[model samples]
Structures are given as structure tokens and as C-alpha cells.
Target: MSRIQQRVAEAKAAGKKLLVAYIVNGDPQPEVTLPTMHEMVAKGVDVIELGVPFSDPMAEGPVIQKGHERALVHHTSLKGTLELVKQFRQTNDKTPIVLMGYANPVERFGYQAFATAAADVGVDGLLTVDLPPEEVVILKDALDAVGLDNIFLLAPTTTVARAQKIAEHASGFLYYVSLKGVTGAGHLDVEDVKSKLAAFGQLTDLPVCVGFGIKDPTTAKAVAQLADGVVVGSVLVEKMGSLEGQPAAAIATAVGEIIGGMRAAIDSL
Candidate 1:
């Protein structure tokens, strides 16, 4: 199993729901990224979805869009993000790091070269927001060769047939975009999500993780009960955005507290 798959399996065996935290790498500043990563893991994040900033992040809401903008000011490229992951791996190796972003950067870096560098730097998975399974052959094949997980997203509007096709290509875990709108938009309908998850469970045994619209411990706990994992993103990114001029340790602590609360709530299950 890849690091991501192993981490998810361990959480399942222990009767615990995974808490995956998402943050834009080099947000506010490049120097703060590594410390914040370590702090999040210490606060109980099972998996780290480190977003590589792209000029046009179509799936992200205003909050995360601004995060990408801030990171871009510091010139956070895909190469720079990988360097952050390498630095993160120096002191910590167990927590799975999944690079989440657009396809352009990976393509610019070259598929095979990007995958090899990512795996060498301890990256566990890739979730290219715009890369659908149909067009994922070159990238997915590269990741497969490097033993890295190729993660995919399934939206609320996805047809049963489409989801089945996506499940066929997805590994590590499938990220279920909880909101019909962009990330950080809309409120979650717990019953609707529950029903959808039940239907998805019939299609594949792979762990299904819910993201987008999970903003607090209450929502985190609620989603934890239905899915194998709960992914909290926007709220944390919003926090990071608000603390732009603050010290790195303070920023890390602030975000860590959010994860800590959600962790407590998930563990309470």
C-alpha cells in the first residue's frame, strides 16, 4: 500500500475516521509552510492535502482563491511546493502528504519527472482538480510507476455510471465533493450525503472522504459518522488568510487549534 492507503487502512482498523486537512502551500509566505504542516499533523490531521497554487483555481471559492493569490505573490510554483514537502519529510515521514492542485503545473514539469520527484520527496498522492479520469492516463500511469496514489474527485451531480468509471481509476481514496457549488460554498444536507454515500459504497470498497463545506467541528463530527473520512479545507485556509502578517508559530498554532477541535469531535464518535 502507498502511504496514503496505509494511513487510511490504519484509521479504519482502529475504528477512527480520517481527518484530512487542506492548506495552500506557501500561503502568506513560503517559510511558514513547513512548520504549519508539522503542527497540523501534531494536532491530529491524518492526511495533508497541500495545494499547489495555480493562477486560475476554478474549483476554489473566494477564500481559497485569495490564498492562491497570496502564495503566488511569493512565487510558489509546483517545484517550490515539492521543496516544502521535502522539508516537511525531514522531521516527519509517517503523515501522508497529498499534493492537491491543477494539471497545468504538473504538465509543465513533465509527467514522469514530476511523479518521480514527488515520490522521492515523500508525496503520497496527487489530486489534480481539473484532471478527470478519462484524460488521466499519462499522469496516472506516471504516478502508478512511481508507486504514488492517483486520487480523484466525485461531485454531488456525478451520475452513477460516471462514478463507477471514476472508482475504477481511483486509488488511495476517493474525495467526494460535498457541495454542488465550489469549495467553501453551500451548506451540507446530511441526509442527502448519507444516501449518496450508501449508493457509492455499492460501487467500490475504497474509502470515500467528504470535503468542501465542512467548516467546523460540528460539521466534521456529523460527516465523520457517515463517511470513512472528513476533509476540512476552506475554514483552515480562511484562518491562514486572516493571519497573514502574524508569526509562523502563531499561524501554525491557530490552524492547529482548528484541526485539534475537529479531531476531538471526530474522535468523540
Candidate 2:
């Protein structure tokens, strides 16, 4: 089984839900990336979605967009993101790392070469934001060849037919965008999310992870009750951004404490 599937299965077996955390790599600064990563995992993050900084991140909100801008200022390329994963692996190997970004960098890096290098650097999955299901066969084949899962997003407006197509193509876990708008936007109705998750349960056995507007422990707990996993991106990134220019230990404490509360809430479910 893929590492993602294994981790989800382990969470299921333990009667606990998975807590997936998202962070823009090289955000705030390049040197802060690895420390934040290790700290998130140490606190409660089961899966790490390390976002590759991109110029045109359509799906991202203002917080992540600013983060991307900061990362780009450091010239954080796709290759540099892979190297960060390699450096992260030097100390930690159990936590699954998923490169989350747009397709331009991966395309520039070449499908086959990106797959091989990602696998070599201990990356467990890829979540290309703008890549559609119909266009993922080549990338999927490349990823499958190297044992990396290709994760996909399903929005609130996705039709049943499209959802099925996504379920068919997606591995790791399917990310369900809870709100219709972009990331970090407010207004996440838990009842609507619950209904959508119920509908998705009928279509695929793959674990469903809900993201977008999941900004706090209460919201995380509510989402966890309905889905197999909860993903909090914008808020955490915002917190990290707030802690910029501080000591690494301070950032770790602030971020860890915030996510630790989230972990506790999810576990409380």
C-alpha cells in the first residue's frame, strides 16, 4: 500500500482521524521551512502538504499568495523544494510529505524526471492544484512508477460524474474543498460539508480529507466528525507568517500550540 493509504488505515485502526497540515515551503524565509515542518509533525500533523511556491496560484487566498511571494523572493524552485524534502528526511522519515502546488513547475521539471527525483527525495505524494483529472494520466503514470500518490481536489460544485472521475484517478486522499470560494475564505457550513461527504462515501472508498476555511480547532473537530481527515492551510500559514522574524523556537511553539489544540480537538471526536 502507499504510505498515505497506510497512514489513513493506521488512523482508522486506532479510532483516530488524520490531521493533515499545509505549509508553503520557503514561506517567510527558506531557512524557516524545515523547522516549521518538523514542528508541525511533532505536534499532531499526520500528513504534511508542503506547497511549492508558485507565481500564479489561482486557488490560494491572500495569506498563501503573500507566502508564495515571499518564497519566490528567495528563488525557491521546484528543485529547491525537493532538496528541502531531502533535508527533512535526514532527521524524519515516518511523516508523509506531499508536494502541493500548480503544474507549471512540475511541467518545467519534466514529468518523468520530477517523479524520479521526488521519489528519491522521500516525497510520498503530489497535489497539483490546477491539474484536471482528464489531463493527469501521464503524470499519474509517472508518479505510480515511482510509488508516489497523485492527490486531487474536489470542489463543492463538482458534479457526481466528475466526482467519480476524480475518485477513479485520485490516490492518497481526495481533498474536498469545503467552501465554494478560494482558500481562507470564511463561511464553512458543516451541514453542507456533511451532506457532500455522505454523497462522496457512496462513490469511493478512498479516504476524504476536507480543506478550505477550516481555520480553528472547533471547525477542525466538526469536519473530522464527517470526513476521514481535516486539512488546515490558510490559518496555519497566516500564523506562521505572523511569527516571521522571530526565533525558530518561538515559531515552533506558536504553531505547535495552535495545531496541538487542533489535534486534541480531532482526537476528542
Candidate 3:
């Protein structure tokens, strides 16, 4: 099974919520990004969604936009991001790494070559933002050839027909958008998420994870109580930005505090 699938199964068995952390691969530069990843793993992060620096991330919000800009300032690209993953494998292999980004970079890199390189560097899955279900079939085949899972993202606006189609192709896990707007732009509606989950679950057994605008322990805890997993990106990215001018230790320390609270929410459950 895919690591993400395995994680869901294990979390289900353990009656725990999956804690997913996301960060741009080279933002603040990989010098800090790599260690932050290892730090997250050490703090028991269930999965890591490393954003591949794409020129345009339409699905993302301002926080991630700024992160992409920061990553670009350091000349981060698809190939360089893959190299960071390769370096990550030198010390850790257990934490699942999902490359999340837009399809533009993958196309620019040549889809087949990018998938091959990502798999070679130990990436476990992918979450391409712009590649809708219709176009995903081709990329899915490419990833499957390399033994990688293609994670599909669903949202509130998704029709039953759309959800069903995405679920059919989804392998790693389904990322259910908790809100309608871009990442970090909306608030959680427990009732709404519950409603959507109920509706979407009718079509597929894939473990559903909710993200977008999830910011703190209260939100994370609430999501853990509802969804199978909770993904935090913009909040963490914002935290990274907040630690500016502080030493690397301060950066790591601040992140640990944020992750700790979110993790506590899951543990309390």
C-alpha cells in the first residue's frame, strides 16, 4: 500500500488523526527547509507535503504565494527541490513526502522525467494543484509506473460526479478542501465539513483529509474530531515567515511550538 494509505489505515486502527505539515521545499532556502522537515518528523508529523516552487500557484493563497516568492529568490526549481528530497533520504526514510504544486512546473520539467526523478529521490506521492481529474489519468499512469501515488484534491464546489471521478483516480488519499476559497482564506464549518464528508464518503473508501485555512490547535483539534486527517500549510508557512531575523534555532523552536499545539489536539483526542 502507499505510505499515505498505510498511514490512514494505521491511524484508523489507532483511533488517531493524521497530522500533515506542508512547506515550500526551498523557502527560507533548503538550508532551513530540510532541517525543518526533519524537525517536523521528529515531532511526529504524519506526512510532509513539500511544495514544489511553481511560478503560479492558483490553488494556493497569499501565504504560499509569498513562500513561493521566497523560494524563487533562492532560485528553487523542480529539479533543485527533487535534489533536496534526495538529500532528505540520507537521514530519514520513514516520513512520507508528497510534492504539492501546480502542473506548470511538471510540464516544464517534462512530466515523465519529473515523475521519474521524484520517485528516484524517494518522493512517495504527488498533489498537483491544477491538473484536474480529466488530465490526471495520464500523469497517474506515469506515477504508477514509478510506484508513486497521485493524491487528488476535492472541494466544496465539487459535484457528486466530480467527487466520484476524483475518488476513482485517487490513490494516496483525498484532500477535501474545508473551505471554498484558497488556502488560509476561510474559516472551518464543522457542520459543513461533516456534511461534505458524509456526501463524499458515499462514493469512495479513500481516507479523506481536510485542509485550507486551518490555522491552530483549536481548528486542528476540531478537524481531527471530524476528518480522518488535518493538513496545515498556510499557518505553518506564516509561522516560518514570522521567525524572520531570528536565528535558525529560533525558527525551529517557534515551529516546534506551533506543531506541538496542533499535535496536542490530535493527542488529546
Task: Name the candidate that leads on TM-score.
Answer: 1
Per-model TM against the reference: 0.99, 0.98, 0.96
Considering lDDT, where higher is better, how would the candidates rank from best to worst? 1, 2, 3
In candidate 2, stretches whose alpha carbon ends up further than 4 angstroms from where it belongs are none
Assess candidate 1 and give its lDDT. 0.93
Q: What is the RMSD of candidate 3?
A: 1.3
Off by over 4 Å in 1: none
lDDT of 2 by residue, 123-195 (tens): 9999998889878888999998998998999998998888999999988899999999899998699999998
Which pairs clash in the backbone of model 1?
A: none
TM-score of 1: 0.99
Clash totals, every prediction: 0, 0, 0
Candidate 1 lDDT over residue span 1-269, tens digit each: 67887897899799999999999998988877888999999999999999999999999999999999999999999999888888888899799999999999999999999999999999999999999997999999999998999889999899889999999999989999887989999789989899999889799988999999998899999999999999999999999999998999999999999999999999999
Error of 1 at 145 (Å): 0.7
**Candidate 2 lDDT trough over 10 residues, lowest sum:** 244-253
Worst 10 residues of 3 by lDDT: 244-253
| Each model's Cα RMSD | 0.7, 0.9, 1.3
Error of 2 at 71 (Å): 0.9
lDDT of 3 at 155: 91
Ranking by TM-score: 1, 2, 3
How many clashing residue pairs, candidate 3? 0
